[model samples]
Target: MSTIVFLHAHPDDEASQTAGTMRLAADAGHRVVCVYATNGDHGTLPTDLAEEETIVLRRRAEAEASGQVLGTARVAWLDYADSGMTGWDQNGHEESFHAADLDEAAGRLAAILDEEDADVVVGYDWHGGYGHPDHVKVHHVARRAVELAARRPRYLEATMNRDHLRRIFRAGVEAGLFPEDEGFDPDRPADDGNPIGTPEAELHWHVDVRPVLASKRAALACHASQEDVGWMLGMPEDQYAMAFGDEWLSEPGRPEGIEDGLPF
Candidate 1:
């Protein structure tokens, strides 16, 4: 069986973007591992954190629990601090992921790729889906790691399908399920001033993950400390499935698209 490594920006990021993919790979007898770029030191303050526990500790614990729910065999952290948002002051901190040395960060991940003998590795889209600094750094570092690793694993950039999101939002608005004026706009500039995701024409793979959507939601539920997740979990089941049931990927320079399983 092949080993699949998923490199994510923060703790709950894996649950949101790749939980279903990880579970599916594990169920198929493949080794599934998750590597987080940061410990999420700058994430929203948890109201429930114990006096002895800091945000970093709480977030790491949540990530590990999330990995367990997704059937991931191993979970690793690169030990970088969270680079808050795009323009946040923390972005300039030496220990922040956004400010980490590129070669150093890539070397760390490259070592993991070599150790795991990974067959495939997944990272975020070019703009990291929504332009978060840590996420954009993930794109660069993961790609660099693939280039540096001796294993030379196949690389796939995980991304949302912008067109699909727009369509879903539009339909939801028409159905009055989502308020027409309050609905998300995928085309709007995000954290780093880039639009949400790549267009359909640029995508290479669309993996149907509805089979593991339940596991995905369960994985997300593990990060209860993140208040943002509450709104997501409260979303209507059908809407949640419609929005997350399909995981999209892009292989640079690939022209063909797959709507089923991964090449592995």
Candidate 2:
């Protein structure tokens, strides 16, 4: 059986970004694992540390539930704190993922990859899918894992295409979901796009997951705290399904025999 591992920035990331693919892989009897780079402690809070702890706990539970829904065999965490986007004060905090030891982090992930004997390892693109320090770190570690493992593992990076992003943004704008002033910014690169990152054709491999879109949404709903349910309200279910029906994967050195087709 082939083993597939997804390395992500936070808890809900797996669900929102690639739940359908994971589900499809699992349904096909592959061993699937999710590795979370952080506990997602800094996402949001109720003004109390205790409350925040409760939220983190809840988010972990939600992650577990979502993993089950996607048929993931295991979930692992690097236990780092969430580092808010580029300009946020949290970016420089010593406790944030940005401050964590990159070599050590890579070693930890490498260990997981070794143990799982992963055939395919998935992570974010080079820009960290929007330059999130944690996401970037994940990409680094995933690359390291492939390098350190005894057997070479195919490293796949998750990303979107320029055309698809434009369409999604335009649709959001036309539907009044996003303000007209929301335009891409090249200077402050992180400020230019989605919470995750945009896609680049050079670094991505596209796969249509239309058959398992419903499972993807179900997995997304599992992470109630991270996602804003209201954002999905305005979009029609069919539209939502169509828009998220595809996923992208990119590896440093393309694996032989892994053709471009439905992963399942």
Candidate 3:
């Protein structure tokens, strides 16, 4: 009977990061809402676009489709321009999300939380799980929004289990789960030259979403414009289930976990 709101950096973030949790939330009869900080204007443009089609518009549709698959009660966009990768020229763009004032952006999210009467608010981890500037900004903005909102909703941050990921990658290799030349080194530093995800010790919850794994994979497919998420979409159902069977989250400022998934 609670309302949960997920604040993400872009269109597909909802799918890549928390689709399973969102699906589980909705199936449990909770009101699940998603608010994106940007329209994903910088994402890969589909090759089949009509003469008048635009990346912004296309990404919007994709997000909406993704929302549908995830069973989100509502989906909203903040309409900020995407701030591309760490050093891309778009990072300095005036309309980029990273350029927006923190309080101002946080206020926007706070408005949604208030409107939705949100009982739980979820955002990205401190390093954004890979350090994209806009994602990192989401962490800060969601934290600030918690202060700006009137509700004392549970605040959780989504993240990956780095140790678990390494194990999965290695196990996949040993089992010949992936093509040999995949060259995916789990230990390699992600966008920020830092290893991906938080250590298992830092995670507060490990949500087994395998029951809703199909919904999660289907939702990820709706984001056709994101190349980074494509690998997941192309994965076989069993492989996808095995890899994305669980989601991880942590409570803000609490060294020890308060409780499992969404603190529910």
Candidate 4:
């Protein structure tokens, strides 16, 4: 069976962006592995933490649980601290993924790719979905790791279709699910001063993951420590499916129009 390794910026990212894809891969009997670049130390503070528990430790456990929900064979972390948003003071942390040496970080991921013998390695688009510092770093690291690794895995950059998201957002506003003054415009500059995702015309793959949508939602549920997960899980079933029923991807240097389903 082919092995697919999903490289993500933080612990819960796999659940957000690639859980459906991972579920599909695992169900097809492929070995699915997840590697996170940071410990997500800067995520929302959980209220139920034990006295001695740290956010990093809690995030790590949540990530492990998320992997279990997706049927991931293994979960690995690079151990870098989370670089909170673009301008947050946490960005200056010496050990944050954003502040880590690029080559060193790539080497760490390359080591895992080598060990897994990954036939396919999935990472983020150039804009990193929403352009968080660590997410942008993940884009760079994923590309460099493939080059530095012994196994030259097929690289697929996972992303959202910005056009699709815009349409959905407009629909939500019209349906009163979102306030017109909500100020969440997809056209607005994100954390990196660019729009959220690649335009649909530039995409290469449109993976219909609706069949595995339940598993994707469940995977997100595994990250219950994050307040955002609660918001996502509370969405009406139809609305949730409309928002995340498909996953999009781009291949390096490929100019091909979007094709249906996972190519590898």
Candidate 5:
């Protein structure tokens, strides 16, 4: 069985982005392992002050449950503090993942790759799938892990094309799924303080996961703290399926001429 490693920036990233794929792969008899880069301590917390740690514990439990549903072979953590985003002053702190030693982080990830002998390593695109510093760090560390591994595992980064993203955003708007005038721009550069952007063309790999849309949504729901339940509940089933059908892989040296959009 081919061993696949999915590296995520936080506890919930796998469920939101690649849970269905992981399920598909594992069901196909492939070994799938998910690596979470942070504890996700910075995510939404309940208003109850006495249960702050309880919230973190609950989220971790949710991640485990989601992983079980996806049939993942293992769920590992890098145990780094969440580096919220660009404007967050906390991200600039010494303990933040963005400020951590890249080489040391790489070494930690490299150990996992080496131990697993993974055939494919998956992570967020250069834009970190949404320009989060922790996500970007996950991407970098995952790549470095592959580099340091003796096996030279294939790398896949989660991403989206500008054109496809626009279509999805437009569809969402037309269906009253999201705000039409939100000014969704996916072509912005990562360093320009924008959350969404078109990833580099050479590093993109598309996969059509329409068949697993329901499972994907279910997995996403597992990340209730990060996802907007109201928004998800508002969307019609078909629209939801369409929105989650396509997935992008970011990395160099994908199969040549393997189609630009998702391949079912």
Candidate 6:
């Protein structure tokens, strides 16, 4: 069986963007692993955390639980501090992922790619899907890892379909079910000053993960530390499925079209 490696920016990121795809790959008897870029040290402070549990500790524990839910065989961390949002003070910290040496970081990730003998490698879109420093760094480091690794895997960039998200939002608004989410303008610049995601015309793969959506939600639910993820979990079942049932993807430099599955 082929092995697939998913490289993500933070803990809950895997759950949001690639869990369903990971689960599907596992279900087909392929090996699936997750490599997180940071320790998520800057994650939201959850009131429910135990007094002894630091954010870093809590987030990694959550990541392990999420991996279990997603059927991931192994979960690894790059061990860098989370680079807070685009303009946060922590982005400049030496230990922050944003500031890490590119070759060094890519070398670390490439080690895993080599170890796993990854057949398919997944990372984020060019703008890291929303432009968080760590996310954008993920794009850069993953690409560099692609160059560093001896294993030649098919690389797929995980991304949302902007047009699809807009359509969903519009329908929700028309039905009065979803008020314009405050501060969320799909057309407006996101953390990286880029729009939310690539246009549908530029999206290449549309993996129908609805069959595994339950596992995806379960994975996301493990990261209760983040309010945004919790809010996502609160959506009605059908609505949640409607929003997350399909996991969209793209190739590094490919212009877009219909591709049914990851390269085998």
TM-score per prediction, in order, is 0.97, 0.83, 0.94, 0.96, 0.86, 0.94
Which tens-of-lDDT digit does each residue in 172-204 have in candidate 5? 888787677788667655543654645334445
List of clashing residue pairs for candidate 1: none
The lDDT values for all models are 0.90, 0.75, 0.86, 0.90, 0.74, 0.87
How many backbone overlaps does candidate 4 show?
Answer: 0
Q: Write the per-residue lDDT of candidate 3 for residues 30-144, one digit (tens) a residue.
A: 9999999998888887888878999888888988898898889899877799999999988888889998899999999999998988888999999899989999999999999
RMSD to the native, candidate 2?
Answer: 3.8
The list of candidate 4 runs beyond 4 A from truth reads: 174-177
Query: Per-residue CA lDDT of candidate 1, range 106-134, in tens?
Result: 99999999999998999989999999999
Which of 2 and 5 is the better model by TM-score?
5
Candidate 6's TM-score reads: 0.94
What TM-score would you give candidate 4 relative to the actual structure?
A: 0.96
Model 2 lDDT tens row, 169-238: 6776787655669784333345424444444545435667778887888888777665454355345776
Task: Give the least accurate 10-residue stretch of model 2, judged by summed lDDT.
Answer: 184-193
Off by over 4 Å in 5: 47-53, 172-179, 188-195, 199-204, 227-230, 260-264
Candidate 6 residues lying further than 4 Å off, grouped into runs, are 180-184, 253-255, 261-264
Better of 1 and 3 by lDDT: 1
RMSD of each: 1.2, 3.8, 1.8, 1.4, 3.0, 1.7
Clashing pairs in 4: none
Clashes of each: 0, 3, 0, 0, 1, 0
Error of 3 at 238 (Å): 2.3
What value of lDDT does candidate 4 attain over all alpha carbons? 0.90
